[model samples]
Target: MGHRGFKSSQTQRGLAMVELVITLPLLLLLLFTFGEFGRMLFQYNSLMQASRDAGRFVAGQAWNATLGKVDLSATLQSQTKSVAVYGIPANPNGYPAVVPGLTTGNVSVAAVGTDHVQVSITYTFVPVIGSALPAFYGQSVPLGLALTSTVVMRAL
Candidate 1:
């Protein structure tokens, strides 16, 4: 017969709690780390897509020489910024709620050589878990990472 005074169940009463106490932080750390990394990747893809869209627009556009030297590059730049940020004509607040601090200034449309148009996007990513975790890669992981994407296409 089992011990009459002390039950086997009683001895294991806090076993799960002890295990949780030891592993909870580790599990949470991994969870948040993965989440933050995923977010960074998602934002990166979004930036690349946006830049590609802008590139497509600029490449297929016909240059306007209506105003002598004024040209339409400036106007094209505005449209490119709008398209890249909002995926539409205009959305004063930049992208949706996914990427924070993205603005028109972060996008650049430049003419490379005489036939190529380049669209570049720059963003600073601040990680949520980075601040709480230890430093890695010889720097504080929490320090914002600068992500940049560029797309270039020949002018039509």
Candidate 2:
């Protein structure tokens, strides 16, 4: 008559362990997916910033008096590529690239009109987490993502 509570059996010892084993991988997958998406967004923004800067620089040039067109020098083009890749026109060694396979050659500079300049940049985004958990899931994810940014600006 002292106590009438039901007592738990030894069979319940592994219930908590089984639940954790089943749910832990799912929880980890959700967490990593969010992180990977954030990483992709950051890389894309960096590309846009680089292209806008290059386009701005080119668009600011004055039209040539003799040529009657907004003349561009090779030096300016070279500097544009340098700035797009390394984030600085004068920096030789790249400061850790945001995209995995980005290069100076991937940046293109072109004149769209008499007063407009366009800068295009391409990058490949590979997720570090997506490829690591292939065994946990049955499906294989994409190898990488291709990202491009183009900026066109009119001369001032």
Candidate 3:
């Protein structure tokens, strides 16, 4: 009876170790996935806010009266900064500073028509620990992700 009891205890201990080994990787994977998903959500929200602010500024402006002297870009840039905007890239002409995780483009204005503007932002997200997965595949596949958002508005 004593020998049987010892054998049963050893078997239980081995099973516990096996269970832990199987569960630990799954637990860590879930945690990392959740973290990446949260970051993506936050970035998407920030881009949306920035686009709305840019559109509002364009809609609130008055047409310039000076001939050959209209500089709406400056106005947009100022309003963008005043609103504490983020996640929109700067213009190539270096008018407004680019947001760290985003890029902006395709801005235009009309003289005798409604002023039109577009704001865009892009983000690249990477998993916290998933980057190492490619090694197991013998360097066969690459993993990368990107997201984009765009908003447009016309002056009233």
Give the Cα lDDT of each candidate: 0.77, 0.78, 0.54
lDDT of 2 by residue, 61-88 (tens): 6346577677778887788787777777
Q: Which is the leading candidate under TM-score? A: 2
Better of 1 and 3 by lDDT: 1
lDDT of 3 at 12: 72
Question: Distance from true position, residue 9, model 2, in Å?
Answer: 5.1
Instruction: Output the number of the lDDT-best candidate.
Output: 2
> For candidate 1, lDDT tens digit of each residue in 86-135?
78656666447325678879988887766677888999888864434466
What value does the lDDT take at residue 55 in candidate 1?
A: 82
- Runs in model 1 with CA error above 4 Å? 1-13, 62-72, 92-98, 129-141
Poorest 10 consecutive residues by lDDT, candidate 2: 128-137
Model 1 TM-score, 2 decimals: 0.74
Whole-model lDDT, model 2:
0.78
lDDT of 1 at 65: 45
